[model samples]
Target: MSSESSKKRKPKVIRSDGAPAEGKRNRSDTEQEGKYYSEEAEVDLRDPGRDYELYKYTCQELQRLMAEIQDLKSRGGKDMAIEIEERRIQSCVHFMTLKKLNRLAHIRLKKGRDQTHEAKQKVDAYHLQLQNLLYEEGKYYSEEAEVDLRDPGRDYELYKYTCQELQRLMAEIQDLKSRGGKDMAIEIEERRIQSCVHFMTLKKLNRLAHIRLKKGRDQTHEAKQKVDAYHLQLQNLLYEVMHLQKEITKCLEFK
Candidate 1:
């Protein structure tokens, strides 16, 4: 009974390379596969022309194998032979797919290079135009300065313009305050707001000047009107005084 039991037990299967074969692959096969893939990757990176040739060769081989399989099918070829051809076709297809991916990567790399070159050119042109504009602006400011020094009247006009700007900036600030949603103090500290404390002071000074001028004009007009009214009253009073004196003289005669 013990011998029968022992005979019924299955023996461990071993592969020819001496490893247990129960679905276990040989280390050499795995290493060879890895080495092959690594070399292929290296070839793809180092020599694109070689990869292209491989792609072309695979395509031709695939076509020839397909034609041969069709011929064998029509001739009633063995099933094992047909299956072997099919597997070879599958490998060719997979390799061609990798080649196609590499080709697409190359195309995209070239396209990106073109776009970068175009962007660089645009940036250079923009910088050149900016430099020209800066030069013109400096020249204009220098000419204006020369004119200002030659003519002092321009200084007064400039002062007036500055006053106007101050007033306008103040009005804008006041509007912002009235609106009250924005944090004007923080914005000023951050330099996000255009006006500062110095401009606010100028605004106050400008307001005073504007008020003084308006008040003087109003007073002069009122003075002229007052003088005309006083002159009319004096004429009426003199006429009344003369008439009263005449009446008194008549009464004295009667007495």
Candidate 2:
């Protein structure tokens, strides 16, 4: 009794490939044509054949239930049988809803995998760039600190695009590290470290140069003031000597 009840209660499971079974007594359809059209709707069903598969399914199940109502005719009145058919149709609708939910879940998973793969590709390309930089002379040291100057208000769009979960980025880096990329990874990291130090040194040197230039200007001004004072004193002494010589000449003439 228990086994029979279980079998009766079991759902008519839709196969993984989207095809229903051959008949009420069987499992899934073997032929490919009976299978669901595709993962994506070609033109959202009405535009083309995209909706054809789902609706075709509904019509098929409706016909099947109507046949079953005919079988139930002698046992129940026409009205009651028709009502039961209506209920069966509702069940088919529920089944299709389940299928849709499954498909939606699959699409989400696929999308996530694709995004992670692309993110990994982006990181790999960046690592390759770092490796290439190893052959060239230091450049970012001379290049302006564009990253440091990033103003959040001025670059709101950029910040929005870049600001994802820090944990996700860390996980990706850790994943890369664990993949036995030790040598290349270390090299790229060392280069980044060097780049940072280089930029800091350049900034410091620029600041020191400005200070030295300002001090040189101040010293030059002070030297100019001293020279002007000396020149004024020399002129005053020459004038006094000339005045004395004139006075002595006058005295001699009087004697």
- Give the TM-score of each candidate: 0.28, 0.28
Q: Give the per-residue Cα lDDT of candidate 1 at 242.
A: 94
Structure candidate 1, residue pairs in collision = none
Would you list the clashing residue pairs of candidate 2? Answer: 21-27, 21-28, 45-51
In candidate 2, residue 71 scores what lDDT? Answer: 64
Clashes of 1: 0
Q: How close is candidate 2 to the true structure, as a TM-score?
A: 0.28
Q: Model 1, range 1-255, lDDT digits (tens) per residue? A: 999999999999855775465787878889888764344244224434444566677777767777766677777746658576776768677676766757655763564355445545665576568668978788433332343244345545755776676577667644543343325434322221233333433454455556555766888999999999999999999999999999999989995
Local distance difference test, each candidate: 0.59, 0.55
Evaluated at residue 239, the lDDT of candidate 2 is 90
Best by lDDT: 1
- Which is the leading candidate under TM-score? 1
